[model samples]
Target: MLREVTAIRYVTPLREGGSLPGVVEADDLGTYVVKFRGAGQGPKALVAEVISGELARRLGLPVPDMAVVQLDPVVARAEPDEEVQELIKASAGANLGMDFLPGALGYDPVAHPVEAGLASRVLAFDAFVENVDRSWRNPNLLIWHNALWLIDHGATLYFHHNWPRAEAVVHRPYKWDDHVLKPYATALATEGPALAARLTPSLIREAVDLVPDEWLDDGGKDAYISHLTARAAEPEAWLP
Candidate 1:
């Protein structure tokens, strides 16, 4: 199933993606927004998405179908002319792709709000486990048909560096927690346990393998793979 995506056609540039997620039409007619790593952040950003997004899916969080796409030269240069081609080629390293959510709107943690009760608890569960991609500016939480979907989990397990930092640090996960998601607390709490239980080592490994080869360089490859493998082996323990 993973190998099928042999090409990626650049559709439009998504400026809000920070690293610039190009809307891509896959060979299977499925469309996705591909996010490439910018100058400062390394390819590990893409790796983070593979590891954490899959973990969230196992935890029963609403995550979209994700995969590693190979950007063919024809598709890569699919832009208007040669000038655009150079730009695409320049972003060769971390040119990771994501499944684009149609008619999706970004959720506002403040104007939109999340609950500290159940929704908050689930997000907290995400945090406790080191899934740090859920942000305030671009929550990356998509609203489709009144249902919330999560995308772009490129910043998770950050505490892997600060493993021995502290014991159970606490601050409200998000500022809007009390207003928006409070009502959904029961719903979040109900699904939280089942989600956490499903995160098996095999699942984690499968997710890690989904990352595109180009994203991982020589020195980074082994460390990236090892990091995820270790995280999968012990889900109950703190990241890193």
Candidate 2:
């Protein structure tokens, strides 16, 4: 289970993508970029974030530490923005929080050249998860302490949004032409297969298990495990 922290203060709104994630101070004295469940994407996005982020961590990828934030609607009282206050009130219970990277900079492919092997691994991982958000125009990456860190995985595993069509698209081919790291992922032919081999059913299940029970209210744990395991089993179909 993830460490649980209660949100103690509502910091500034990030105002990034549509979800409107915000910086928040928690009881643990840590600042987190919390993704509110009341956001447009709803709890399923949080579920994807937890599962995919944890899976990346387990696969030896760099990711910010995650915690389940216990939020109280009262924290919204100080917020100046009515929109933000409403969001906080709606997401009063559990939300997903990623430890804030203090001095991290958004990844720029030219400014921050990534090594071929790491890029390959990242590409392969994204392909496996069907993450369509890591395009060149909007690479959801950060350069922290001279290393690459993956973030904002809520866009992955989109098949869950339509369960009936999941099987048909589980092994769908990944179009890598526009992937931000594609140019640097020269070792994908080798690293891709190697990474796929590591995505065992047990590992997938372990990642899925990390998601909060409330997020899995749809009872989709088994479905996630099965879909990921099946996709992992046939890397050739999805590896870019």
Q: What are the lDDT scores of the predictions, listed in order? A: 0.58, 0.92
Q: What is the TM-score of each candidate against the true structure?
A: 0.68, 0.98
Highest-lDDT candidate: 2
Candidate 1's residue-wise lDDT over 1-240, tens digit each? 244364457777776766656777877888877755542455666667766776667666777877556665567654765544655675653355566778988876555554434374456446434555554544567888777787766666553333343222222133333323434455544454445455565665666566666665554444544554554344335311
Question: Clashes per prediction?
Answer: 7, 0
- Name the top TM-score candidate: 2
lDDT for position 79 in model 2: 90
- What is the per-residue lDDT of model 2 for residues 1-240, given as tens digits with 9 covering 90 to 100? 998999999989987667999999999999999999999899999999999999999999999999999999897688999999889988988999999998889989999888999999999999999889899789999999989999999999898889889889987998878999998999998999999999999999999998888887564699899999999999999998
The segments of candidate 2 whose C-alpha lies over 4 angstroms from its true place after superposition are none
